[model samples]
Target: MWSAHHRRTAILGWLVFVVLATVVGGATGTVTASDDEMGTGDSARATKILDDAGIDEPASELVMVGAKSPDGWRDAAADLSRALDRTGRVTALKEPLPSKDGKEALLRFQIKGKSDDAADQVQPVLDAVDRAKDAGAEHGVTVHQFGDASSEKHLNDLLADDLKKAEFTAVPLALGILLVAFGAVVAALLPVGLALTACVAAFGLLSLASHQLHLFETTFSVMFLMGLAVGVDYCLFYLRRERDERAAGHDAETALRIAAATSGRAVLVSGLTVMVAMAGMFLSGLLLFKGFAIATILVVCVAMLGSVTVLPALLAWLGDRIDAGRIPFLNRRSRKGVHASGSVAGSLLKPVLAKPAFFAVAATALLLALAAPALGMKTEQLGLEKQFGSDAPLSVSFREITAEFPGGPEPALVVAKADDIRSAPARDALRELTRRAGKGAELTVHARQNVAEIAVPLPGSGTGAEAKKALAELRADVRDVRAGTGSAHGPALTAYVGGDLAESEDFTDQLGEGIVPVFLFIAAVTFLLMLVSFRSVVVAVTSIALNLLSVGAAYGVMTAVFQHGWGASLIGSEKVGAIENWMPLFVLVVLFGLSMDYHVFVVSRIREARDRGLGNADAIREGITRTAGAVTGAAVIMVAVFAVFGMLSMQDMQQMGVGLGVAVLLDATVVRMVLLPSLMSLLGERNWHTPRYLRWLPQVSHDEPAPAARPASPTWQHV
Candidate 1:
């Protein structure tokens, strides 16, 4: 439909689609998930029971003040409590609690609305904290604020600031790289412009979808990062091919057709493969994963459509003017295509073609070496201490509170329920649970009617290794309480552990259990896609292995940097000591899809040369050399976009951005440039082999003429 023959129709249709998507998305605002909706496993169940009892735990935060003088500390605590309650955004306020030594005190409160609404209502609470800080200073005390509402506000604000910074950083850097590659301002800007446009459209689509779904806050950034990287990459593939064909002396129409016939087909295949990998996230059985997959799939599909339909129309409209604003020396070099033959890729290909076995073994070994650290990679849900930004006020306050107070703000809430807790046996069970909790841990339990909420004070911000151990011991004793109770009710009542620690542990366990199925699904699907695309079993197997190697290396690098704190010093990150619970599944789905864009494009070019009667060695060199310039340019652009994500203050965003950027670098340089050629060079003619049983697979050509060895008949026509 976007063929040059329908130039005006294609151009107008694309413009309408982008505009319509945005308008519809704006009309229906996004709907965010509730706290219970965000949960999974034991933690989720505990939260649900709390909710059913009409309890609203407003993500309570605290303002802590410390002083040497007992009189000053008491005065500061009174002042802080009154100031917070006067804000009118809080539903309930608790009396200030003082430490035994009278050195510190904390005022706690629940926000007026639900947990999700707390972030939006934090302005009043913040203003109150500001007042407390000033009042504490005058009273000869120190004050700091940290809690659930404060965390939401700070993280949301930080992410918004980081995204704005990324735009200003990534776009200009990408344009400059494109200028160096294309040697013309107009030609270079096209890819970046197209990428930005696609992101806007993807945002529109996601916004519309959000009404029918429960969108997470992180989904927007994920879409932006993925949409921009893949959009530009697809555009670069098509534009480079069109220009190369034009440079080879073809007219405008002919160049576009050949570009569409080749790069366009690769985009379709690559986009489908990305969707397939994204589909694996649905197996996770977590709403967060499913939501992420839906949003990203929308972005990738929209970007793919633009690359095929609108990109061709834009090129057709530009004609000879695409290269109008050419740079002098660079233009001269580009005009003669110096990069296609005299590049480092060309030099590197020689050794691989000469001794395929040696290079193949060496490159494989290096990738595995990079992947070694992942074997010991630890997993955890980031605690408050781990999730906090270094400069966030709440983080500073949290540290102060932990140092000065016996029990900090964060504590584990263990909720247990029964029909009639006032009965003798039920009462004994509750008493026994409370008694057992106090044995080896600092704990307190409160009972009202049929329910009991046991508050376990977690020392050290309530998320350290010792805190977790205490929680485990408390849980072990709960079984004993269950055995002692509920005969009056005629059934044993069980307590569910839920809190920051429980949520993290449950999600990590979920990821661990579900990841194998997701991985196997992606591997099986990608291998089949490659098999169908290449019609060679060896090629399909090689693609799958290389992708695994690249993803494994990414995981290893992430573990070393984020888990082991290897790069924390250089990057100014607070040492997390564990990976984010969601990162491994997220990276796998995204990396597999993205890495395939380059793999399929280069492999298609190689197959074309082979079909054109070149020997395996010659075809490998020509195909890789011909496509190397564009592939490297696209890869660099992608890496640049991802690197900007590393600049964000959020730890999860940093981990993902750096991991993706590094993975792409590895895949393009080692896997694509070195390992691929070596493997193919070793296989020779076997690289193109197709079994008779698989002859029913459709033939998708890549701008290559029909082979003289085969009969002339139309197998497929879309490409």
Candidate 2:
């Protein structure tokens, strides 16, 4: 109220806050998640051992020298080694090893730097490799490079490009949609502008928070994606309600108050619901999820605050000027609620209201059918081959490297700590371990003092089932070796088998264990919040069920398209055969949270109608129709924004984008528009039922007092 009456103060204060937050965040900078923090299980323990021993694992790279004939590989390998040596970034160059066919030789080397900085520092080395490639091409010898540094560099570039594209594409796309939704340039710009500023402020604040939480590199991208979505959504809801009130012939002040009392209340409830859902990630037991939760929650809070405070103030200051620069036909349609009066929602609602049971049963059955595929859903971490697509240069290089020398790109490491790794007993244990690895596998050991690292080249493509089997066998072998060497009750040497595959597997297991608890936490809290807010057990239970259906349907779609290869070609996405391990849990939390925005807004509107003199069916119809345009606009904007991510090169991101986009689309139309109203109609008065025990819960209402009787306006001009 104060913000609306003192518009100038509110506006200037918001600008100052944004600027200061940005400056402070820039000063604090961000801390990336450390390797130990990112690791899990034995992999994490292995990393801790290595770090404690002051052992630094430099970034390793490999160059495959392939020739038409055997003798050519040695010369090409020699030249590439010299070229790499001249770059000064190369260290510990290993002897060129021959492939099984003897026609390919692999030149292995490490980049001279901290492994984390290797991606940024490897450009000079890559330039040298590129030159080597050009020279080798003249000799009819193919030289391809694949390794941690090169692949990470390429992946980082792809991520940056994708985010930039999304930033440019999503913003204008949102603006254009809002323009159509509002039918006026100024009104359309308001939401977009507020959303953008909120994202900026949240970005700065999150950066500062990163110093304490250790955020992932993708945290900012996720924050921006979510911020723009919810930011615009909240503002759209508030502005539309205020405009509707004015169009109903209330003076500007009354219109603003009604909007604040109604949509403003919905925004608050919805934002809290979203934050609660996002907090479910804290139960995931992974630093990554914790960081993601903080990022999302921060942006939502900032956006929600902006919606309730500055947005109302801006509307008050603009008054009728908010509707200036109106487009002709668009303005007329918006004024007449053309989106609802004869629209699809209206058309569906008629039959749905008339035959509520039939429509309700049918919608429920269809959604359940769609959700069936999720029963077989499987998740795995995407390797370079799948993440960057098979045709990408880095993927091609990795495939070539793995083909020439299996598991050469990423070998499993067995870290053993003993009294003295150089002692005869330790040496025997290590030798026995290698012998048990069998004939086709090659093993090497690097030992210093009491710490030793044994590298085993796993069979088959890295990250494939074969490699996983190899890792498991190696781990078992180490345990046996430790037991054989033990003279006391415990094993003489402490050992951990760790590598990229181990890390991925361990992380996947962690998520698997966390899923049930996290889901239960989110569902329980959301149900409680809804029940208390709506003062109805039926509304709470049904809302949870409907959201679960939406999430399940989205999961089923992702499984079919990404894993089962159903309709994969239609969208230009590949059948990666498994969803990204983190995607399911991440999507569950995000979708459950985001879908509530529309769910709460629509339900609140419906409850408002019911609070008035309207009957259940009438209230359902009125609520769905009246809020159709805004909900559709919000859903479309979210879907469009997420769809931009679906076009990204990374399969995991594609899954996330598709999963979220599909869920929002389903929620807004099928679930929110059809199933919800039909179900409510069938339930009738039971929709608002609360048990006697729960009746003591405080009454929370988004309903505003009936508008006072006033002189009717000649036309809808006050808006």
Candidate 3:
């Protein structure tokens, strides 16, 4: 009777989501204004080149140069200068500067605009550079250009190109996974549609939030994609269950209520669990993780709302229509497999039950073995060039420059304050320190009345481990020098190192310290929630243990692939150094949430069967069989969506994609499919038993209380 009411509510909920998605999508175009502001790697490199060339301060005069024999290159440069003049942004460009590489050209220009958009005002100058390329080509010369304005223009274009590719791959892959999982075209489309709606709304909300808080550009796109994948996954569980119930002969309304009461409750708990897990990122004291945590929480909350409200409502409205186009080869004959009766899962579990002590010890041993590598897991910063693309021109050029100049690109800065720099003893000490630092390399010292700044050029090429080691040595030398400089300047001469390596080291250290506590907190919360939901100590403990095993194995795989350089060549990354600093926290939050989702679905069904008066063994067998197909299908879909990230050029995306895909696949198959059922079946009625005092807690039973006696089914009913 109450089932029909819930179905109507579910239909109405979906309608709301659709409306919200449409309104948000229509109001905002795909591109944002900030897209223009986020400059390219080329721009960063160009700025570094100019800075190194000692070009600073506002410029009114500029120059442009082209290849000597290339008439076409000279013409193109002239055209770009005219374009810049047309914009009324710059005063004029001087004739091309002499080309360092013979085939390339350079341009110097003057800024005329008072507007803050003066940087953007140089668009015409960029156009002229492009035009000059043709001239260089005609003369068998390549037109390579470098300048502040040209660099910015190049960066913007590159980012736009990469973004286009990412969108092209992520969307189609996500939709295709859904289609295969649901079988029916329309049914599969629903979750993707809902996920898109949530993501659009999240982007708008995040943009607005950014005005009041700090949010990185990368976070927005990554969170949106990840949130969509998870949201679709959440909806898939509920919708699949509802379909299964209807196929089993329950009316649409009854199926809706049953799904909502069971799967719906699971969705709510799972969503909250995911949110709680993500909140652990707050412990890192990093705005990046904090932003992600907040964004993820919002997306999960919206997804949960859709699962409970829209999913049920859609089921009621569609009725049997949800299963209209079943794929001939793929549709299950009977949503039952090995665990259908006291058959496969039950029989397999029976043996484990017969020797619980052995199986328990064996499983524990396996988990510990996989967990061993994690103890030695090292944390380090991924090189930006390596993250983007090892063979990219910027990366290649930077390497060349570093090799030629050594630590010229990356210098360790040592800043110290002293009571007085005029003292003969202090001057001597400083000179000696600088001489020692420069012994094996080039070191430059600058001193003021009360301060000294030392620039130490490290040995070997820059942008890799050797450069980092040199910086470390320089810091140690500075420390030794400070210690030896006695009481005259001792207290006031405190020194601190500040540079690329210092900042990166600080970030990595913070990330490592925060991961353990955050993981423990997430585990503790998951344990309490499971205990409260199922009222069984063993079940709660077993659930956490299984989740950890899956996570551990996933990390081990990452260690092998990313850290050990296994298959790295296939992926395009040259050096496999260390995992991303924050990947562990991100992986933990995501894995815990996903693992809990499956756990709740499987256990909830078992509890439903048990409530119908079936013994623990029979209920588990039935529960697992009924739910396994749907769980497996859903996991496959998720795995597919996550795997798409592996196609991206970005290293961070690859790590995230591989880590999540492996974890989900393992949890769904090995841990959930085999181990969970085996463990539960062995426990029997004890699996659902609660402690004496805890019996007072409210319990929602899925089955109606049975009459004292009933006729047994001919095939398998037992007295």
Candidate 4:
């Protein structure tokens, strides 16, 4: 058990963690020189394409070529160039790069930074392009631009704009919800303060890591916000329990110690669950996922540390000050002078226990109904161009361009190589394949070669079945042609498909395959831990079932809101076919951590009650009642914080935020508050039964000297 001295020691430990984190974080903040040749398949393919096409000049040496035949276009391009010149982020290409075809006019620009950063520099060039649009229209010329800078700029601007709104909405709303739930200024502020500290630490660490590692900027706000939610949520549970114990006549130190031994241990277990679940991302092998895993793990670890150390320390230091502003409007005070038996929480549990079997069955059935839609869930790649508000200028223009000329901006490339570059048979086969591919109304082969690239324009509906089928047919045809040739000299050929759809499909496949193993791993670990801690088979099984229900119900809610487009407009993202591919796995990992927190709290309390000689049924009802209000309060605070993310413009953040928020809310309420207690009540004394072989196992009892049996009275008061 954690004593007052131990609490003080823990506080000192946190101070040490903070000091070390700051120094280590700062030391890693500097960007390091990276080898330009360290690139992936896509990068290599892009390089090969450019080199083969004789456009292999370094991006820094490239410049934008602009024409002034159209009205206002020249002035716009000039103005954008001026802006870029001032920022010095990139060198504006003053001269137009020569076109591969003499018939076409091109505007070429070069960026001095990494390929990723090049997209960040595209905004000014895009603005110039927009300005020149009207001029081009007058002269029957259209401006089309593509480069790393342009894409980066577009994504950066889009994320920045959306994150601005999220900041404005999520923080205030989350705070207000916490304030209402806790009904005390200091108590409400406590979780928020801890969450902010954790998030700030996480952000600094992530940013520093990004200098050396490939960290996605879009996931930063999400990680920060969710970290805040989880931190606050964990603190809320322990603080509420501490307050309850104090009200039950225990001294401050005793109550704090009891809460730590019970809720604190739960916090540790839950945090570990979340950390391990997140660590599963390491299996993905993708740099983005690895970065996300690292960032999430760091945040979870920091939040857990805060929950156990800083939170307890703050409670000890604040003492009575934590209850300074007991808002009469929000406080759920007892109506009569009659003290509710069993820890001031029996009244809430009594109703559910009245019809335990019915409530249990109904809750389970409802969760299953909600989970039904998840079976058919499909994933699609969400791009900034698709997620922007309908009124956004870029979105509108992009839509129009795609509609007018299928795949005008984004085209799928067909890459192939042949041993006999000039062979007539290879030429005939290529032409035949092109002809067959062009027959599909969904796509048009714009360009081709015997040992070269073919630009296949995709349909306007980017992810329609027709597009998928067309790509399939193209692949099949290419395969058939290559198979007929007998010699190794018949052009060693391989096709590399690159596009938003392809990337999305790849991501989705990876996510699906990864989910089962990850969930099983989490469940197995949780089961082993619970079994070890409680030494009860019934307890372990019940915990797993309850956690799954919580996750299921949360998934249902997410399906309705995100997949069904219930509040798409308010969230600033369009319903783009399906959720992001990795969202489910990410949610599972995160929710496992969060849901386990409540499980530990409830189970620990039940064990405490049982140790006092309470019957199994009585112990469950009493434990649930004592913990319900606190768990519910924590869930609400977490939900509110996550809901703030729903207001973000970025589709990825919106999906993750909504999914995590709903999961925590459902897990706390439907699963923990209702289903868990009812099922335990139905099981009666059998709920705590352990196998005969487990009798020799070590027991994890927090209380000393089990209480003696008392008369069976209607009222069972702790004191």
Candidate 5:
């Protein structure tokens, strides 16, 4: 309550912190993860060898020229090459290579810089291609371009647009939900304001953090979404509790204290639990997850801090004015409280508590039925066509190019390194690799270096099953050729197959291996945290089980809708046969963490009711009735935000949005309202049973203190 007592200092201090962090973070700028650091297994080794040798691959781009006649296509392609050469942004331009059908030709070149800088430098090359399109207009010729640089540029642009859309949509949608929940404009705005500031502050902190641990391109968007969701939820919980206390006839000052003692403590515990679950991502050992863990944990911590300190301070300062601009009907209804006889929450809880075992069994069955589809869930690294949607220009170009040429756009690279790679044995090994690679492999040797690259054409679109099969065979060929063709003299050559396909395969395998450990880590830590917080073994176990159920159901829903193509057209999603490999673990941890917010908040309220001499049944009913409105509002807000993301064009965002939205909806409604109460009712007093061994653990009370028993000092209590 020191913050409440010094409201000006607290508010000003928070503002200054946000501004400084943003300024400092912006000044430092964010460092992005390099492909070398992102690669795994052999791909990583290959990249490392090249990186160590200071051999950076220039960006490879291709211009595909199509026409009714071969003459027209070749002429158009030549014009494109000359036009590209005139741009002075390209080098090593190659002659037009004819497709098998001879109706199209491909002009290949490298952007004249490090591949890392290609996305930025490829704009001129794209413009040159655009200009050459007109030169081929006569003869019905058409030019399409696709490559590493174009794909990167397109992804970046798409991400930027998604971020903007999220900003404009999520904020207003959250604010609208809060408006309905609070009924007062001022009261509703408070949570939105707090959440936005927390996001701003976390953004700066994440930028600073990125220097030590470089982040993925989408990290900021993820952070923003998480920050808004949790920040708003925490503040909503705190604010609603304060308002409830005030309406219960406590003076403003006393209401603030009680709210802090009860909801503030719950927020703290809930935040800690969320942070622990997010930490599970670190066990995945992927750079992508590491950045996500850092970003989410940072945002939750900032939101938690703001909830306990700045939120309470703001509530204190506002006093009666917090209810300004209240809608007449909603204000009266809000003041009428949640325990009314006609309340929907009460009616729902009545049946739940009446037949605890029956409701519990029914709810569990329902969730299990939803989860059944997950048993057959298949995972793969989605090709760009599926990821960005087939309608995307890049995907369209990819399809056309692959149809015309045996190898689509990207080629598999076989990198070999050793002392004297120019030796006769190395030459023989290279020749064997080319022979095995069949028809379309080209070799390039560095001037004085020991490394050589054989670019082998990949069949089908570079991201499809055909490409993966070809890559696997090529890698096996590398292994076999590596064993037999090495010189007897010094050291044998070390070869690795590396390219986009190789990276995807390695990444998929890495995630597949890491999933079990990550799941166990999250579940174990969550169980321990819930046990310590609730001081009950049953409570902790149930918490984990319920969260897992909800997560499982989410998986099933994603699989049914996305993988099985059941009603996918309704959501504008493509029916890719598999989910993204990174998605399962990422969704698992994120859902587990986010689901804890409702679990902790609702359970804390129930425990508080029970501690006040209510029987298990009555406490479940009472606790659920009192907290249901807020929890439901928070859930709606979360689902709305997630749904906005679901509407995005990117398959990853769409899946995340639907998966998270469905999980949150289920967690808040069926799981919390029906299953949690029914199970606790069945357990009765045993729900609070704690063994003698757990007596040594610290006791954290979330109950509101009685008027006379309340501490006098305006200080926040430590749990």
Candidate 6:
């Protein structure tokens, strides 16, 4: 596939595939989930009832006013009320309802359009509000506009700006790091070019995938960002290998062929591991996780394919020009001998190898310590109040509403669907339920033709303990009321709980239920793959252990920073007081797979040395000495990429960046460089042990040549 003569075919074919995917994706675009698409249980039922009733849930704009008199406030609010009515954007407008304290009042408008598409209707409403505010100021009244539509627009804009900043910042930073590592223009650009094409194609494929599934608007940005980093990483691994082989005096064809066999095979295995890990998130049974898992997996698969095929072909075409325009200080070592400065590897390995128990225990202890905070970790998805900055006027308005109104914007809705809500029996039951609920929370009950809704104002963010406690008591009271009504002979009333807090709790709890099983499944599959690939139970099992430690450590670190608020200000971290519900599971799956990239590469080299009849100790020494440069370079690049994402303002992305960056660094350096060698050294010959029953399995070979003529230096052996 990577034949030197086929360079043009490989390059041109890749270009064509990219173009077609992009065109197809553009034609199809993406299908995003609206509130109806995302909701479940009682919330979902409520949505259906409203839809069946042909009731459009109005996108409301709340105008709160503070002025000298109630009459004066009404007059000021009337300006916005009239402005909204005149703009013709609203289906209806309501008169100002003054608060118990004459200082504040509420005015509401039902904006035009489907609630999901209501952001478009916001601009005109905002324009009207702005004019109304100016008018209120003339009358010595202060007006602040807040609404569901206004909040959505602000969030949409914030996320867009965040992604744009990341794109502009991450690209140059990644390239600069690549330049520093490769120290040559062409060498650096090759990885970047290949990564970009892979991202374009991934986005194309993801667009098509979205229509079949529920994809959040944020999914593509995450895929593209991750694709860029991992794509470049795969290319970097293979390209570095090919360059090394070339420096060892192999021709371009031989170098690339060997890279295909070696780093190429590694990428496939690593990519499979990653995809399998990501696939586990599907079991969480959350549409959001499913979307991210699928999109990320697709992008990784595409990047790996490009690494193996297009990458080798490009190297063949570049030939000597791969090193064209090389930086001055970097080439001298390459011209003489490879930078196989196993010094960092050696310096760390020697003491650990000498005191295996001490180092092993010490390293494990450190990771476990980092992971300690994880035991106390709470998981809840952030609501708008937690997600948005306080600087936004909508956030300020929300605070005011919460201050003036008992429960803020979110109220627990008890929906009862009977054949006829107007029926005497149904009416009596609903009234009793509402009266019982009112004992614990402020309640308003309304009945339509067949459906009755009771709104209970339970304050604080829905995820908070206060809201949960209030909701629990309210539900218990409602159950008691319903049982007392004894509609046993009459039609049974269908009742459900629905609200923002209720939905958040449902999502969090459902995802939590699936996580344990998902973890076991992913772990089992990854272990089997490694065992099959390496033909050693010890290598596979140990790899899993190290990966778990790193992931655990990442969880601990993330929990500490975001949940415990340790050094939170450094990253501009939001104190969400819990890891995002999806984050821990997400980080576990992703980190487990990513941590394996270095583990497999380094351990495989050790196994290859052992195959050449080296002692267990000698093989360990030789393997670490041989691939130290490549492993560390790749690790540094990955860490840098993740750190860039951490620099963004979003809390969820911040948590992800911290987890990934810290874990990868720990996996590459401490786990691989220090603990692995120590543990293997202590275990000695047991490191390669596999059961006799496993001997019948088909043998898999990496880039090992058929008893090749020995190269000048052992550094160029399998490479």
Q: Which regions of candidate 3 fall more than 4 Å away from where they truly are?
A: 1-167, 324-376, 414-456, 473-496, 569-575, 682-686, 692-719
- Clashing pairs counted in every model: 0, 0, 18, 16, 0, 0
lDDT of all predictions: 0.81, 0.87, 0.64, 0.65, 0.87, 0.78
Candidate 6 lDDT by residue in tens digits, 233-283: 899888878888877788655777677777788898889888888898888
The digit string of per-residue lDDT tens for model 4 on 326-409 reads 767654442111133234457656778888888889889988887776766666665546555555655665554445345435
Cα deviation at 461, candidate 5, in Å, is 1.2
Show the lowest summed lDDT stretch of 10 residues, model 1: 710-719
Colliding residue pairs in candidate 1? none
Q: Quote model 6's TM-score.
A: 0.92
- 1 against 6, candidate with superior TM-score: 1
Ranking by TM-score: 5, 2, 1, 6, 4, 3
Q: What are the models' TM-scores? A: 0.93, 0.95, 0.74, 0.79, 0.96, 0.92
Model 3, residue 174: C-alpha shift (Å): 3.8
Which residue pairs show collisions in model 2?
none
Worst 10 residues of 3 by lDDT: 34-43
The alpha-carbon lDDT assigned to residue 165 of candidate 5 equals: 99
Worst ten in a row by lDDT for model 6: 710-719
Q: Which candidate do you rate higher for TM-score, 5 or 6?
A: 5
Candidate 1 colliding pairs, count: 0
User: Comparing 4 and 6 by TM-score, which wins?
Assistant: 6
- Per-residue CA lDDT of candidate 2, range 607-668, in tens? 99998879999899889987897898899999999998888878877898899999999999
